[model samples]
Target: MLSLSGLALFAGIASAYVVSNGTTCYLYPESQIHLGRNVDDTPSIHQAFDQCGTNGTVVFTEETFHLNTVVNTTGLLNCLVELKGELLFSTNVPYWLSHSISVGLQNQSTAWLFGGTNVTFLGQGGSINGNGQTWYDENQNHSNQPGRPITITFSNSTNLWIENLRIIQQQFWATFVTYSHNVTMKDVYVNGTSNSRWNTVNTDGSDTWNSRDILMENWTVVTGDDCIAAKGNTTNLHVKNVTCYGGAGMTIGSVGQYPNSPDYDENIVFEQVRTIDTFNGAYIKTWQGETAGVSSNGDAGGGGSGLIRNITFKDFDMINCSLPLQITQCIYTEDAGACETSKSRYIEDIHFENITATSRYNIAASL
Candidate 1:
């Protein structure tokens, strides 16, 4: 039987339309909110300019919608939008030969990079499922890079909250929060598992770069790639109360640059994290010239500025890990490592506490 989630999953091919050159779009059950299901809502939902405020709450309400193009917000600034839904992949209606439901459910798969601030995606006991098995399976027979299905971008946005949702299999990274601040991701689960063949790749849990004031808690990550990663000028960030089953354990840096620029990172905190059946415990790692790691990404022994500092890793219980923690400044002229070895910079303090490896590749700390 086809996965139930596969049946209910929206192809995610939405196109943004201009609405009287509007500035804000209000949605809720009370207002004249048109959901994605109704033809009226399609125009109203698309007409939303820069902001989609509380004027309405666009609800999927047990429906599957598609978007064949980009959903742009007309370069809106400091805008706020709230989308609430209660959709479950488990509630998929069985497809029958005499079915009324249509075929070609798949939409023109593309990246959905959302650009907005103060946005809230609340799906209490619900999910915005991404059935990525087809994407992963496609890569098995060929040498093609998987397409990043939808990019929910929060560029230069502040006080963003993405909570109470389960993000499933994807063609690429599940969630990418870049250049944003005061972001909180609560009770989120990102999974890229296949019951048959290997249907996962580059399906990162959450990737944060050049951001600050973050809180990632109550997460269950079971991906084939990094569980949660931080990259570039990310400071004053915190990852607490997380449970990661498989993937490269909590990556730090994939940093490296040319005279065009350098790198810097600081003030990071990770606590109460659990690594289960993973490859590494927690990485305070900087990558090679062309490196990539989830938990983090920094250059090792590069002559720019210390890209990492004030790091705190505490109360982490290890279920099964392959490699422990390793902290060493790298030398571009030599091996791969951290950017700051004998020197400290933009980064000041580093702290780690209370970590246990139930099944690991190594021990506690390798700093």
Candidate 2:
């Protein structure tokens, strides 16, 4: 994305690799951005972003330091920049910024929202803790006035690579992307420890609501909610070699007039996955509510005709998943809740091979 320019950091740090932008920086073998210092990583990060000629890299040192917000209103994470850090070794953003997001609080963790083409956020077995304990209890009286502590927010980009990162304990969806293409989130570990009971809601691992060329592989997701959620007219997505535990399994089309403004999910692939103790192994159905986001599909779409086609799930092993494979076209109508059911979303060209399951509920495939 970027043309190599003044990459003092990459040039100093490593010799064999690709820099997002042509810009270079020497990532000193021994470097630390102390909490209290005149030197800053944000500037260094943006410097790479600046030189990406177009794309760049943001590498974090092995230190726990607070950070200022790297804001991008264009809904893009600058195509050439590379944002990486030495995981568990370096910490950034000690607390959330109140002025940056919709309802940001001190402990909110989903602080850094990133998206762009040719962008990579790689870390070495480190943790991006979204200290969600501060704002976990906003139920009736308040909406999410408290910001969701997510690792990254991808919007409208192409060619993304997120690997070897441990994203944990966020207040909301861990990684939420919208309108992007050719994305890959691999070798990623998303976890939600029950340190606080209220600290978990919608902690989705990787959500491709409306995009394509998505690939999520070799991942372990133990979250408070859906491990991987697909929504509204998504196309050409792939989820392979993953293990999901303690949440909803790979979900497609929790459809409720979603895409909020566009096409739905199609051409998805889920292979070599194992699910354990979750709500459902693979779900494809529209929700009941559409007008508002308050209730979880209480009264929704005219029914999905958005084509959940060409889906392939092979070599899937399930153990004790509550409701293993449910494909329902049944719509939840107003008067009866389960009434309107006439070709909701077309589930064509679907194939399930070498699938083994031990579910409390029967393996029901609604065609």
Candidate 3:
């Protein structure tokens, strides 16, 4: 149920300090901020999480920390951030389209709404930099541009621990976890590239909605979209040794899209994956209950129902991937006989074990 407007957007308190016990707040970067002139270290990083954020330890030793405002810093507990510096964000985009921070999903937005509990984000080799080439040249026609933020959001809170992070140029979807549970993202290092042909579209590399016991391992994504996405009410998700170059692989659900809302993805798992040119090394997308609209990345939805059960895609290794296995209940349907006469939203125990693929096309499993 989460979503009391996503817990009131992670509450308040932007300044104050006192709590101690191994405390260690050491941030700094607004002495007339440098490197292309940027300032506003977001209120001294919310006053260093109001000084050591609880059980203490918030060191971001400034190599660059611009962030033109908005960084919720929710109810932290046994906190510790130590990202040796480099946050950056801020191509301004209309003051982040009037101050970002919306976790209600789909109409996504976030410039960091990081939550509470036993949190720990240690990017020893720090980096966030969502300078996303001016939102990929103003979303070069891939639409869905409502204040494009999503470069940091691990909502509500739990026993979270994001390690060795380095999500680059991401103006959208580089990490989004909702409500939160025992989250654990390891050695992350995403790179949503684009040198002005304008197509770092939807750059997803770690996405989970409504969340549960999540755990993404040793990632190394170079995105375009979904290197990892278990959307909808995702439950015990666990992705292992990931490595995708071009995205859209290892996904589950564009999801049952809101026909009176009832979607629940269960025990999901993608293990030891590796896709190079990717389009799909393992993907699944639903949407065709009573139909709906908008999705060429504009992301609207359909008549969602629910239940995508115990899923698993193990040991995949696709090189020239185009579709090493894909599923679609006719997402955003354009009359495939009216999406085969509608009503489809319960994908059961899906599993694909030692899959080894090499395809650029010529149909490699597309259902």
lDDT of 1: 0.54
lDDT of each: 0.54, 0.59, 0.82
**Quick one: ranking by lDDT, best first?**
3, 2, 1
Better of 1 and 3 by lDDT: 3
lDDT of 3 by residue, 217-254 (tens): 98999998788888899999999998999978899977
Candidate 1 lDDT by residue in tens digits, 141-251: 222142334324445667777777677765456776666788888888888786657646567787777678888888888887678877666777788888887877676
lDDT over C-alpha atoms for residue 281 of model 1: 66
Identify the leading candidate in terms of lDDT.
3
> In candidate 1, residue 75 scores what lDDT?
39
lDDT of 2 by residue, 1-367 (tens): 4447556545544432223324443232222323244332344444444554253334444444333454342333444322344322112333343443431211233455466656665666446665444435432223233443455667766777777767766556677767778888888888865555554566778777667888888999987667888876688888999999878788776654542443456778888989988877777766432233333332224433456677777788888887777775543444344344444445677777897888776654444
On the 0 to 100 scale, the lDDT of residue 316 in model 1 is: 77
The TM-score of candidate 3 is 0.34
- Identify the candidate with maximal TM-score: 2
